[model samples]
Target: MKKKLSLLVLSLILLLSTSSSIFASPSGFTESELDTIFEKAGTPQELINQMDYYTKLFIVENSGEDFEFSSNSTSLYKFDSTLDTFIEVKETDIQPLGYIPSTDMSLSMYTFNVTVNGVAMKEIYSQFEWLNKPKDFPAGIGKDNLGIALPGGYEIQSGRYACAVQTKLEKNDAWGAASSSRCTNQSPVVNNLYGAVWEFSASQNYLNIYYKGTVKLTARTVSSNPVKRAVSRYSQARENALGNYGVSIGIGAASISYTPKSGSNDTMDADTNW
Candidate 1:
């Protein structure tokens, strides 16, 4: 009887997943309901393994707190875990996500948070979804586009980007990204090569909105500390994220996306095709 109920509950989740409109765990998918289901499946992470890509099952410890998740309408802030705190946060200043990146690197890689009109959010990241990256870039070009190569005695051309094989890439159709020419004002930008859709962490609330802005690239510098390198990298990333990458930021979103521990056999893959 318990097994039958589990299958019935799963069918309902699959049914809800097909809807185009976003919902916060569905109107009546209360914590008690989820707890009952998950108790059968094992851990929350284990439950994710049995589901298809992008299919989310939110779990809540508080049965009466009214936990929810949904995305629609464009706003500076898209979530309110407090049930409705979609307002700017307090006198909080944006700080590095953790200990600042080492001051001895030459590539950009750091994280921080900021508030707009008081709404607090953190910068996600700026990088490719692996599938969109060139299968085999030149030796010096980093797929992440975070490094500035200086091959010995080779001419330092303007910062370069990696490109994938023609046949392997999705065609420049309506699904492909808009032409890079659309933003003549931005530098160090790359087209998604795919349109309307974006790669995101499935565990977070799908805010699905973006902000655009420009960022200046790092001029040639003699700095060797990782701090300087990290700063330049993050600044460019944040700005380009606002401009080209469409950095997704919001409050109440949890890092539910699972990251396997080292040496694990999980072949982490993105949930997109073509």
Candidate 2:
């Protein structure tokens, strides 16, 4: 009877996985890999043995919150614990926003509060996640974009961002994230990519939300007039007195969409896809 109930619940989750929403966890891997995973058959104990084997193969943890295990690794299998059988998280996770300055490639700490219906919510992260990053990063490149060569004078380049959520809690509750269909701005300014997302829960009179994170990209822009500038003669004279060069800030054009972590903004869904 318990096995039957587990199967029923697992089926429901699998079905819901297809629905367009932030909760869907996609299986991360190639089609062939997925087929290989689907070919496995088993009970919960067998699935755990398989998962343990694959986890060892990848040299990664067998189970970790915020870390979705949808893809197969031969050692790890995606199973419906309720059903005691294999299942898949079609899409899971979220993308976060913000940029890292090129000067110091360090991860910035960003914190925001969540109020659903009207009350604030709390969460926790893992210590290993925080400790794994570098203390100080490269001079001009962030961890995300590091080792990727770029042309000179190219101060900014756009790319997708996938961040890990670091929470310190017994339950290991965290913001699962994915990139929105819409492109957002991000900077590889830190040693390792880390960001947050919000998840949601509701009651008769209350709605609770948590932050999940994923990777997406912001568009790149070029200067319209890179070498030409107009500055005031008087300003130039003042600069000469201070032994400074003429200064004129040139603005470029680009577009970026970001998600706010609190209030009504915390509620995100498939429509939020870019």
Candidate 3:
């Protein structure tokens, strides 16, 4: 009986040693298999811990600073070439708009203060809302309030709510509009919203979490306002793709003008199987 029991124990050991190869999946497996399978591997706590570690690694590698993740909610950031550095700016900072994360947020002066390899950096972003001129205005009297302010004597006549995202160097107050999106070393995947409204921006290294999300302005536009009426609804199919932007950082950028409030749904690449 003792000899038989020893043989059975040896057989169990052999199975345990070979389990990895036995269960190993071949190449070309679908992505869904990864999100589901690995998540099923360990207990809830173990998964959380693994996720937390990976999140930190990703942040540090890209931003060159330590990244802090939260259990509840947090604001995400991106690097601005115009700003020359990265910053996490909350719209609530300048205005008392009520959508700040529960925790108190602070602005960083790194863009103003730091330089890499002799090149200066810009950090903070200055947001602007689109204010198109009313087409119905009297022939002589134009609709654009910013006619004198903007270039070429052209008013904000693009009733399509053209929200031009602008930023200033923390070193100085010279602000420039993001005339063209150029962060990831590639052409912008989608044509910026041709219609009046747009929000958020993305790069190859870091993509806006909101798939359909556009470059956000500091303020919101009134959909009911006569001057800023939408001609057509937002319709861009490529916005739903994940392959376009390799990695992602979710910015829960929101505006009171468009609500129920929205946030980014980020899929971290920490899962090796994916």
TM-score for predicted model 3 compared with the true structure: 0.19
Candidate 2 least-lDDT 10 residues: 228-237
- Output candidate 1 Cα RMSD: 21.6
Best by lDDT: 3
Residue-by-residue lDDT tens digits, candidate 2, 95-187? 222222212121111111223234332111110111122222111011111111111212221232222322222224432332222112333
Off by over 4 Å in 3: 1-98, 101-161, 177-196, 204-274
Better of 1 and 2 by TM-score: 2
TM-score of each: 0.17, 0.18, 0.19
27-72, model 3: which lDDT tens digit per residue? 3223333334334432234433432222222222222332121111
lDDT, model 2, position 182:
16
lDDT of each: 0.23, 0.22, 0.24
Q: Write the per-residue lDDT of candidate 1 for residues 1-274, one digit (tens) a residue.
A: 9999999999988888754233234445533455454444343444334322212221231111232221111111111336732232222433233211222111111122323234332221112222232222111111112211111211212332221111113323112221222122223332221111111111112112121111211122223421111111111121122222222311111111112122111111111000
Of 1 and 3, the candidate ahead on lDDT is 3
Q: What lDDT does candidate 1 reach at residue 185?
A: 24
Query: By the TM-score metric, which is better: model 2 or model 3?
Result: 3
Any idea what lDDT model 1 has? Answer: 0.23
Tell me the spans in candidate 2 whose CA falls farther than 4 Å from its real position.
1-27, 30-152, 158-171, 177-208, 212-274
